[model samples]
Target: MTGAFDGLKVVVHVFGKVHDAGDGQGMLCRLDLEGLELVATQHRVEAGASPRTVRFPLRTTEISYGGTDDGKLVLKTPEHILYAERDELEPELKRLGLVSLDHVLSRERQLLGGRRRKGLAVWVAVLAGCIALAFGALWLADWAVARAVDLTPAPWEVQLGQAVLDGQTWDEVTDPEVIEPVGKITERLMAEAGEHPYDFRFKVVRDPQVNAFALPGGGVVIYTGLLENADTPEELAGVLGHEVQHVLWRHSLRGLYDRLKWHVLVAMVLGDISGAQELLLAQAAGLMQLSYGRGMEREADRRGVELLVRAKIDPQGLHDFFGKLSEQEGTPESLTLLSTHPSSRERQEYLKELIEENSGARYQPLDVDWEGLQEKLKGGAGIER
Candidate 1:
C-alpha cells in the first residue's frame, strides 16, 4: 500500500544479520524513506522452514547508526539490532542522506594526492642532488691528484721508487763488467738530460720480456731480452733515452693518477701520511706493470729524441728500433716495451721528422762492448716474463 513512504526514494540491501525481540534471523532489508521505516523480509534460516518478515517503524524508536569501538556499524533500537561492517553500511547510510561520507572521502583524496606529489618532488630533488654530487666528487678528485703529484718531493719520489723496487725480486745486475757499460751510458745520458729530482739508478734485469720501464722515482729497469734484441749501441741508446724521459717527466706517477680515485687521492694528498707509504709502495708492483697512455708515450718519444740529440747519438736509432719491431712476428703487446710505450707509424713519422730537423753527427758508440753483453745474456738464465 502507498503510505507515507511514497514521497522519497527507498534504499534496499541485505543486512548480514538482524535480531529482534522475536529472535528471528536477518533478511534482505529496505529503508522506506517516505514511510520512515526499515523493512526486513524473508527469513528462512533453516531448511524447509517458513520465512518471517518484520517492519521497523522509525516513529516508534529512536533510530540511529554509529560505529562501535571495534569499527562495526550498529543500527539499533531498544527492541532490535541491525549489524554490518562500517564500510558496508556507511555508503548506504550516505545514500540515505543520513551521513556526510562524501565530504570525508573527498577530503581524504585531496590529502593523499597532495602527499604523493610532495613525496615525488622530494625524491626527484634527491636524485638530482646525488648526480651533481657524483660529478663534483670526480672533479675534486682530479684536481687533488694533480696537485699531489706536483707537490711530491724529488727525494720522496726516489724513495718511493726504491721502495717499489725493494718490494719485488728482480735479477739485479751485480757484475761490474756488465754493469760498467750500463753505468756509463746512464751517466752520459743523465749529463745530457740535465739536473733533476731523480738520482737515476739503472738496472739490467735478467728478464726475457724484451721490455724496459721506469719506476716512480729514478729507477730504470732494462730486461736482458731487450738487450738481446738491440742491433747496435745506438739502438740501445735510442730506447734507453725513451725510458729515461719517462722517469724524467714522472709519467709513471701521472699514470698512477688515473687510478687514484677521488676519495683515495684526497686522503693521499691531504693526509700525506708517511705510514701510507707501504700502501702506496704495495701498489708499485701493479704500477710497475702499467703501460703509459698515448700522450705520455708521445712526450717520452719527443723528449727522448732531445736527449739523444744532446748526447750526440743518432736519433734514428730509436726510430729504427720501433720500425723494425713493428715488422716482427708479434703484436705490439707481445713486447712489454712496445705495450708500455705504445708505438705506431705515426710515432715513427714524428720521430723521423724530429730526427731530420735535429739531425747531427753521431757521437761515442754509447762507449760499451755491446756484442759481449749480448753474448753474455745468450747463455744467461734470464728471468721469465
Candidate 2:
C-alpha cells in the first residue's frame, strides 16, 4: 500500500474566511494530505486575490463528525472549520498515516472516559456460575473471544496490524542480502500454510533480544538476535512458521480482544468500524507486549509443525530450537522474550511429540548457505554473535 495514494485529493466545504478572501461560507474546496492545506480556486476567490488557501496542521486540528448522514468530517483548526465527506477523507488520511476522524474522536472520548462496566446482575450470574465450576467461565470467555475473532473482518485485521506497524519506530534491517533469505523461508512456509486473507509481510529489525512477533494482520518482525541464535536456516524457518501461525490463527487479535473484551464488545454492538479501528490503534504497542496462554502457544506450535511437515522441512528444527531455549532458560542468556514464550519442559516435550508424529515424513534441509549467511551477518547488522 506504499505510495498508493500519492497526489490524492478530496473535496471539502470551508465554513470560514481564508484571510481576506470572501466570507468563505460554504465554499467548496480541495484538500490533499501532502500539502497539509486546503485550497480553492474561483469558488470564493476575490477578483484580485490568489486562490483561497488555508494551512491545515494535523497536530493542532481537531477531527469529528457532523452534517448530513454524519459522514462529514469536521476538521476544526484555530482559524476555520473545514468539513468533508468521511468517505472522501478517510482513505487519504490512511495513506498519509493519519488516523481517521472517527478514530480521532474515539481516542479523545476514550481518554476522557472512565472504564465501562457490566450490569451487576450479569456479573453476579457470571461469578456464581464460575464459582460453581472454576474453569467453566474461563472456557466460555475464550469461546466468546474466539467468536469475536471470527466475526472480525479480514480487512479490519489488516488495518489494525498495519496501523500497529506504522506506529512503531524500528531499527529495521533493510539489507536485501540479509533479508532475501528470510523472505524465502517465509514464502516457502506460507506456500504450505494454505490460502489465507493476509498479504503477509516479513520485516527484520536490528535488536539484541532474541525475539520475533507477529501483528494481528500479517506483519511479522524478526529481531536480529533471533537470527544470530538460529543455528541453521531450518531453525529460522521454524521460528517464522510459528509467528506466521499466530497471524493465521488470529492469536494476536484474539489475545488483544480478550484483554479489551468490553471495549471491543461495545464497538461491535454499536456496529462502529472506526470505533474498532480506533481502539486497536490506541493499543498498538500492547500487541507486542502480549503473552499468549498455554493453549494458544500450543496451537501455534502444532500448526507451525504441521506447516514444516507439509513443506517436507524437518520438524526437528523447531524441536531443537525449543530445546536450546530450554537449556538457556536460567543462564545469563535468558531473555524476557522467553517470558512471553516460556520454553518450558512441557513445550519441548510437545514439540518432540510433534516431530515423532511426523517421523514417517521425508525431511530435507533448507537450501541455503547457513554458515556463509551467518558470516555475512556476523560483523554487520549489529549481530552480537
Candidate 3:
C-alpha cells in the first residue's frame, strides 16, 4: 500500500464566489510531500487580475472529500477554498497521513444527513481498507493473525481463559448437592469424550438467567435459571454436554479471535502472546455476550449429542432442551446475546434428526434422582462439601 506521489495534481475550486473565497471555478493543486502541505497556483484571469497561490499545511489543514478519502472532492477546508479533480491525489494524502481517515468518515456521515444505518456498506469499506491499514499492510497482518492464532500454546490459552473469567461476574455455587452432581455428570461426559488438552472446570452460577457459556481453558458457567427450567436429568445433561463440547472443540478460543478488530488482532499477533491475553482479559466480560457462529453452534450440537450417546445418556436430551428453548416467545434482553443463537429452530430440528437417525444406538437414563435434587436446590438446601 506504500507508494510515492511526489507530484500528484488535482484541479479543484473553493467558495471564491459561490462558496468560500475568491476567484476561479477550478485550479491545479499539488500535494507537496516534502513541505507536508497542499500548494496550488492561480494565474491572472484577465489583463491585470492578481495571481494567487494557496498553501494548506498538512497538520493545521483539514480535508473534506465528502466521502471516503480514496476518491473524493476536497470541498471544505479552513485556510482556503480549493477542489481537486484528480482521483489520484486524495489516496496519496491519506497514505501520507496528512488527511485524517476519521475526519473523512465524519464528513461522509454529515453529508448523508447523519443517517447512521443507511450507508453501512460504505462504512465497512472505509474501515476495511484505507482506514485501518493506512500504510497498506492490513491484509498481510490479517493473514498473519489467522495463521498464528492456532500456534498459540495451551498454557497461554488457559491464561486467556483466566483473563476471560477475570473480566466477568461469577456467582459460584457452593452447595455440595448442586456442586457434586455437576462434577459427577461432567466426569461421566469427559470419560465418554475423546482426548483433549484442556483441564475442564465446571461451575454453577447462581444467576436466574436461562443461559450457559463456555470460555477458554475449560471454563463453563451454567446459570441457575437453566437448571430451574429443566424437568429431567436428561434435560440438564443436554445443555451441559453442549457447553462442554464447545470447550473440547476450542470454540471459546475461536470466539475471542472472531471478536477482535483487525488492527487489534494485527497488534496482538505482532506483539507478545501475553498482549493477546491482556486484550482478551480486557474483553472477558463481553465473552458471554459473544455468540458462537452458526456453524460452530451447529457443530457443538452434533458433538454434544454424540457425547450423550457414548455416555449412555439419552441423545434426545439435546434435542429436547433446544426444542424447549426455541418454543419461548422472545429471548430475554439480558440473555439476548447468548440465547438467540443462530437458526434456533433449524438447530433444534437438526438435533432432532440426529437423535432419530441414531435411534439404533443403545440409550439409558442417568442413574440419579435429578428431580429431588432440583427441589432441594430450589429450597436453598444443600449437602456440605
* Cα RMSD (angstroms) for every candidate in the order listed: 10.5, 27.0, 16.4
Candidate 1 lDDT over 1-385, as tens digits, reads: 2353445546555454567757766554433334455565554557877656556554454333344432454556777776656666556646655423345544545665776689899999999999999988788777766766676777877887888777777777566656777777777788898888677788888767778878877888887778788788788788889989988888887767656645456566567644334445556667777888788888888899999888887778889888888776276334677667666889888889888888555665667888887776776633433
lDDT for model 3 comes to: 0.66
Cα-based TM-score, every candidate? 0.61, 0.62, 0.60
Number of the top-ranking candidate, with lDDT as the measure: 2
Badly placed stretches (over 4 Å) of model 3 are: 1-145, 166-169, 268-274, 331-343, 382-385
Let me know the TM-score candidate 1 reaches against the reference structure. 0.61
Ranking by lDDT: 2, 1, 3
Q: Residues 206-270, candidate 3, lDDT per residue (tens digit)?
A: 76787777787788877777777777878878888888888877877767665664645566657
lDDT of each: 0.70, 0.73, 0.66
Candidate 2 residues lying further than 4 Å off, grouped into runs, are: 1-143, 265-277, 382-385
**Candidate 3 residue-pair clash tally:** 8
Candidate 2 residue-wise lDDT, 1-385, digit = tens = 2244335554443233222223455566656444444443334566788766665666567766666646576777666677676676655565455444446766744543422233456788888887877665556556656667777899989988888888778878776668778877877888897889999988888877888889988999888888888898898898888888999999998888788666666666676646655766677779979999899899999999999999888877888887888788866444756877778888988998888888799977787766766676676843221
The collision pairs in model 2 are none
